[model samples]
Target: MGSDNTDRNKPGIANFAALKTAIVNGEDQLVRELLSHEPMLDIEKSYLIDLAQLNKNHTIIKLLENISVKK
Candidate 1:
């Protein structure tokens, strides 16, 4: 028998929403927690813009901009 372990647990809108909420709420710990689980997570490309627009998180926006420049 052959075992196929592909397409396992994947992130969806729920995960995105949760991470967004954590960021919006300024729960850095939670954000770190989620990132630990999803190492490939990209805040700038994800909800960073939306959240910054909504909550006026200038710090986060600046941080994201810095990250983008670095990349």
Candidate 2:
């Protein structure tokens, strides 16, 4: 795991990049892992939803929707 101080200073763009790569690569496990590690990483305004739509990944969309509902 990254150091707490380092992780806190990490830019949100880095998290967005990782999330985009994970979604595009169809690495659902990686997506979950990234989300788990960066629970504070914001996804609502990211391109993740657009990627899921472009790829017709209904499962991911549903998962995102479920998460949004919970929040």
CA lDDT of every candidate: 0.55, 0.63
lDDT of 2 by residue, 1-71 (tens): 56876878676658667877877787777776666422342444345677878888777665554443223
Instruction: For each candidate, give its TM-score against the true structure.
Output: 0.44, 0.58
Candidate 1 Cα misplacement greater than 4 A, ranges = 1-11, 36-46, 49-71
Across 27-67, the per-residue lDDT of candidate 1 in tens digits comes to: 75665555432233454445565775677766555544443
Runs in model 2 with CA error above 4 Å?
1-11, 36-46, 69-71
Q: How accurate is candidate 2 locally (lDDT)?
A: 0.63
